[model samples]
Target: MSAFPLALPDDAELSARLSARIGQHWHRLLAALRPLYGEGAWEGELAARLLGAAIARPADLRALDQVREAAPDWFQKPEMVGYCTYIDRFGGTLAGTRARLDELSQLGVRYFHPLPLLKPREGDSDGGFAVADFRQVDPKLGSIDDLRALASDLRARGISLCLDIVCNHTADTHDWALAAKAGDAKYRDFYHVVEAADQVAAYEAHLGQVFPQTAPGNFTFVPEMQGHVWTTFYPFQWDLNYANPVVFIEMMDVLLYLANQGAEVFRLDSAPFLWKRAGSDCRGLPETHQVVRAWRAALAIVAPAVALKAEAIVGLAEVLPFLGEPEQPECHLAYNNTAMTALWAALATGDTRPLSTCLTQALAKPAGAGWLTYVRCHDDIIWGALKGVIPDETLARISDFYAGAVPGSFADGQAFQAEPGAVRSTNGMAASLAGVRDGADNAAALARLRLLYGVTFALDGIPAIYMGDERALTNDPDYAVEPDHDDGRWLHRPRMDWTRNGGPTHAAIARFAQLRQGRACLHAGNPARPLLTADPALLAFERADRGGDRLICLGWFKGDAMTTDLSGLLGSGDWIDLLDGTDVNAQSVAMAPWGLRWLVKKNG
Candidate 1:
């Protein structure tokens, strides 16, 4: 093992540099892996493989590794705004997306997450989540070379490219799955395939339905494999068995391969369901955190520039472990699902208590990690995640209100995979959910949109703007008519209309971005502290940096004018509203209908 040759540059200095990096992180990496894989010859072999991949890393990426390692909190900066879109819907292809970098730059976007462009099963691939090939790009989007070129172009313009790497399952058509179907015992062990029906039932008892109405069960029996394969999501997506050490090795290699291709971030899709244990919910288990920590350690050694974001859309308690403690860091970022769901609940009920509760709980995150805050994304707004934080009846009412079932509701959204007596998930574009429609009050709708985005931008995290939301794009009317897109989530996944730009909605977002820039108080390192107010309709938070710079953010959810006393919160300071250059009376602050304010000490 000691004599293993390293595949590095001919320059002795470069080889020594890479060797020292391995030496620094090797103990941490082994510590994370030993509990999962124990003492074995495979450990030495795996280390050799990882070292080779690190040496083979591209020169430009190595340079990036040095820069990111120097400043580990680059992604947590105040100016780090994210834009997410599909390659085809946004710009038609990778080259087209590269050409439209100007649009992203205008919105002050520093992180770009183009929705899963990886190759998927030919038809009905769960909207590209069912990845058939991790190494290849979806032909419709472009080739792997095109992705590399796009990543290079994005990096040149100070943007980090984020790609989704589905960690829990793979499409049945994937090569490994095909090999399993071909009766390869070694490859067959990559996934959980039970030969008995009772065993499947035992596991199903602890699992919850992901798409109860659409895809149903947690196991699918295949005649070719002659067993029931674990399918937590869809029948065509087989769940990987992490009990097998080889599976972990394979996925870690995939991360390094993509990092070398200039991809700066990996969204670990379906991350919480990685480690499955019999007779347990099998979500966010201890083994899952270990796997993520090991991956983080490996990235620290090989490509320190690459960061992982967990797509753990569970409750707040379950989500925190994914953002591990500072001593043993897991993912660099995790989705703020609790706050996202609570924000919607507050808007519907005209009460900010639930949102305040969630934000207060969210203030405690790992020092090195940040939250991925957003107003809307590609997926449905699942209200079920807020089960305990919000009352069941309130969740139901909010869900119905967003689904347009409530009387006089301005929203025109649809319920997704809803079951009777269950907390419902709603789907629609941001503008439509904000009440933009044919006969609605467009001014109020635009204000609602601005108000929601204002809170997201002011929060302590990297706020992500879903595609087409900046222009206040409404729901896709023809979504249901599209082929294999009957899923209601597509309603919000509208194509970008580049021709129709510069609306009031777009202007509002640009203004928020401008205000967010260069403000140390808004940095992710400074957590937002939720403030209690007398009015339930007003949501308030204060963000203060180490340098004594303080910013108070207020969002009024109701459609009527309201005033709240902020003297208690903003004591002894003459504050000015950063949104509009107006002096704020600390004793009595007045808010317009659906108003938002970012307050900072005047001339401090």
Candidate 2:
């Protein structure tokens, strides 16, 4: 079989345009897919159909094309700051969210991630991951018009809207699932349904459990249909079968439908586990990449401004493949999972070794690709997958250290997935993790808060701050009692404590962010090797662009007053500290605990 092309019928102009752009690298993409899809003539024909179908909506397609032509570097801007929150959690509804544009702008946030507000099943919706309908917003949030109005308001404020696309599965209550249960043969092909338990057992031999605490197995037996259904995350989320071409068309249609609604970015949730095979791990399969690439090609012809961001939190090696190259590039952006984990490890152990080591070995992205740096979102922090780098012994010690299980532990976190012999995830607000909640010495807590924020601001790519983190909101006490928020993650997802604006912890965070804003020269600079210092507690690096503008960012991991020589990275010059406007020698300098300094060389 020859590899399929992205060619839809009745789209001659789009076909010609795509053919010109993809002509040189078409054969290479086809060769990679031949082994999995089979070398048949139907491959090219199917590809043409998908491509032609992409441009069926001429008006939406043209608008996207215009964006690509005008601002290709919209994502690479140095001013990018992301804020993630649920629509209802932030304001009250979609229209209410639109009412709060000024609040987002106050924090320098230009990228917004509102978690799945789509219509989902009434019970145990897996935090809206078990999607019932892809196109409609949940009535609890607002109407479709409300979403469009919010998107328009955000766009006018120079902000980008990023919504979720649950790629791997849909809720068992979805139309396809309901139709399949109704004994419709066409809909039955949409999902992987096994008549006998043994077929499920065969795949279970290699499949991994996503929620071992809540839903242990990979397959769930639904008595209503008398068959075993594949559900990796939860019992209600049924995995789709990509073996059928119609599934591809249906999902692609959904993707285009959302782009037309003015979503500039898409969060590709649980993307790695999309394609499955027997006797294999079924996660991050080669077919998964093929599917991602095909989507990329289709989107390129239709909505070029919209970029796909993969939410793969696995090992660094597996994550890099999702950020495809010039021709077959998969995701334009990916969560910096390795870096995110590294931050937590450093915070608990008070050492920067693991953080530096992992970043050094992590893969580099293509020209247009970037990382989305975040400290904490509305999710639990799982360290099991980082076993080797974050040793199991170290993790156990850090766990107690963060939960105040150990003497002098600053954090007051809750335990999640705490089964015996199973490494657990951590849940707590940034303020608690930074030592503000447990009544540490006032100066000590303030110092720790600044240090943590300092590192987050200096990290590579766009820095994203969780809602209420800027105010240093403490853990919510009522989530455990609330029926809707029984999960541990809710402890970290506290409401905005508007009264805490000028409190010591909040001031420390706001000042830290202010410092970051002053040094856009470093955050926006090109990727460069970090200059290592002898002290394990010190994290230092110099960011320089091609034009020779350089900025040095140094932070002390442990909140301790110490002095260190910086001549190695400072290039033997007198530099001005942007924070205090004091001239200092780059040869030897003293910094306070958890203290940060932004320095620029003084040109004579």
Candidate 3:
């Protein structure tokens, strides 16, 4: 069966280009796909689809591809900073988003991730992740044409536009899902629909609930389909069946289509759950990695400029596979969820041991890939990522600390999907989690926020600033009042108050950006080495490039002032604090409460 209706291009140049790309990447593409599809008609069909997408790619994007190929390390540079926000929250519309590019560029953001704006189900669409259509932009956000214009505008400002591609599932109202509900056998194969109760029980035995309080099961009974459809997160989202070759072809087409529309990077949301095998936990399976690798190959062939980012927020061991080995590279970037969780843990416990352990493991990734580091994102701070690093009881204690359930707790955040006697995930704005509120202690809260941002910026990755965090925005007190927005994550996903100017927290972030931009040692390729400190409340690390450039980062998480000697770590070298223009003695370094320092060796 032909995967795409289009034939070979009539233009000789286009044909030659397509053939050349196929020749160069065919082996790799096949090596990734053959395990799933094997030798058959699927090969020719996928080849045709790949060629069609390449032929359809815009000339300007092709030029951009060449530029990116020439500079493969473009995204791994020290200057690469990212900012993530929602279209509706950041800007009222796509054109409105264009007006805000200057603000993003001013913050040193080269990568912008406007959270999922694709067409979704009518109500409770899982924050636009329940995608109904891949090609269309949500009308409320803007039209597809508006997205193209915004993309062009961002490119003009030296920023890349990143969009989420929900790889694991689709809204039940999606065209394919609708077709399946209407009893189309071929379309029904697009999803996993089990008619037998034993089959459902078998799969459920190995699956864990994503939202036990709201949506408790992994399968939803669909009377129209006469079976129970797999729903990992929510009942309205039908998990795609990747076992079918057609599903892969359709999704690849969607990726190419979006790339042509000027999406420079794709956040592969729910990446770890892409494949399923009975009698096993259907998360981070080997088959899932194979599918991601194949998708990576497809993008490399058609849109080399477009990069894939894995949103696999799982344990450290399981998360590393998504960023495949150097020989068979997968994602170009992945969220350092383990480190993000560990940071929160350290803040709650005033112990950097767990954070150091996570950082030490995170220091190793594929050569071309980089970690996406952030203080807070638009989702809950799932403590499960720190399961192996921190004990369950400690994780529960930290969770309670963040929820303000502990005595004298500085944080004022809400718990998400928490069950009694179990460690719960936390949800709140970065400022609120850092203890920001209207009170006499606001200064200390602001300082705490600065310390977190400072550590994030100095890390060996592209540091992302969530929208409104710079302004020290606290939790939206009325988030739960909105219709279909009861999710605790909405507490952090607040609307931007453009009328208000940022304060000290904002200045500190901009300063961090300026300093990070000039430091060659801070490049993502230079893995950060965790420095062992005798003080438990003090977190330290060093980033040293091959050219002898080095930066030692130190942060004091305690509320009271403390002093530590850096002689052991600095080796008697004359060091200067980059954050403030102060000469520092390696033997006697004093730190104020919630203090951060970026130390660099003095120039000869």
Please provide, for model 2 over 1-113, each residue's C-alpha lDDT reduced to its tens digit, 9 standing for 90 to 100. Answer: 23334433455876565665455435554554555556666455545554554555456446656777587656656667788887877788999888877777777777899
lDDT of 3 by residue, 1-604 (tens): 2232345588887676666666666677778777888877777778788887888899989889889989988889998889999999989889898887878877888899999999999989999999999999999998999999998888888889999999999999999999999989999999999999899999988888788898888999999999999999999999999999889989999999999999999999999999999999899988899899889989988998999999988787888888999878899999999989998888888898999999999867876789999999999999988987899988988989999999989998988885444578999999999888755468888888898899999998889999999888778899889888988789999899887568898888888888888578988999888999989899999999888999999999888997777798789778899989898898889898988998988882
- Identify the runs in model 3 with alpha carbons over 4 angstroms from their true place: 1-17, 418-422, 439-441
Model number with the top lDDT: 1
Global lDDT scores for all candidate models: 0.89, 0.74, 0.88
Off by over 4 Å in 1: 1-10, 418-421, 438-440
Inter-residue clash pairs, candidate 1? none
lDDT value, residue 7 of candidate 3:
55
Q: Against the correct fold, how does model 2 do in TM-score?
A: 0.90
Per-residue error for 477 in candidate 3, Å, reads 1.3
Writing each residue's lDDT as its tens digit, candidate 1 over 327-430 gives: 78899999999998888888888898988888888978987799999989999999988989888998888888998999989888988875456887999998
Return the TM-score for candidate 1, rounded to 2 decimals.
0.97
RMSD per model, one decimal:
1.7, 3.4, 2.1
Comparing 1 and 2 on lDDT, the stronger one: 1
